[model samples]
Target: MAHTTERPVREREDASIGELLSAVTSDAQKLFRQEIELAKAEVREEATKAGKAAGMYGGAGFAGYMTALFASLAIVFALANVMDWGWAALIVTAVWAVAALVLYMMGRSRMREVSPKPERTVQTLKEDAEWARHPTR
Candidate 1:
């Protein structure tokens, strides 16, 4: 006669495929949150770089505008001195002024194109806040 031992098999709920997939998705979400937090500094740095680039572009445009204004004035003065014709100089100066105004407006519109609003980042932050308020199980 041999002694026999009885043991009950353990039933693991997480052994099913669905349970495993859910566990993986939950862990992924947590990891995504942590990654987002880690990337905040990088995002801030990139934003600063973008802002600096925009400012440089703006300054370059303003400089070009002022240069055009002064050049037009210089042309008027030169024409007046050399040609000894006040009306011709005045007419040329007025044309230059109008051209400069048009160019300046165009430059302003171009600058507006690169302006940053941070709308996407703001929306992401809002979504993250909402998730934090009501996290998944």
Candidate 2:
């Protein structure tokens, strides 16, 4: 026997106002849940970006510290042999200061790239509001 793929039509015309309202409510709830899920996903993605930015900052901090500690000591001692110890120390300090500034700027740049707002979620929420207002469209 061949089965027809055609499905029965919903007799919305015969449906009571209560049933129609119930359907609208159910649809609205489902739509809300979907929107929330979308928002959560978007937020999670943004948070990951933020986390990466934070990691960059942390790495920069650690690198800056290590550079100051080891490089400063070794370079200062090597320069001390070539020049007065005080001059060598001052020159090493200046170099390390510049290096630290560069690292800080890099970390700041990475932080600037991180956006806490979920842009897609906000846009979709606005669209959802518009659709809720005029669902016929």
TM-score of every prediction relative to native: 0.43, 0.84
Model 2 misplacement above 4 A? 1-10
lDDT of 1 by residue, 7-71 (tens): 22134443667665666577669867866775675577557766765666576567657755777
TM-score of 1: 0.43
C-alpha-based local distance difference test score of model 2: 0.80
For TM-score, the strongest prediction is 2
Per-residue alpha-carbon lDDT of model 2 for 1-38, expressed as tens digits?
99953322265667677777777787779888988898
Q: What lDDT score goes with residue 16 in model 1?
A: 66
lDDT of each: 0.62, 0.80
Task: Please tell me which predicted candidate would have the highest lDDT against the true structure.
Answer: 2
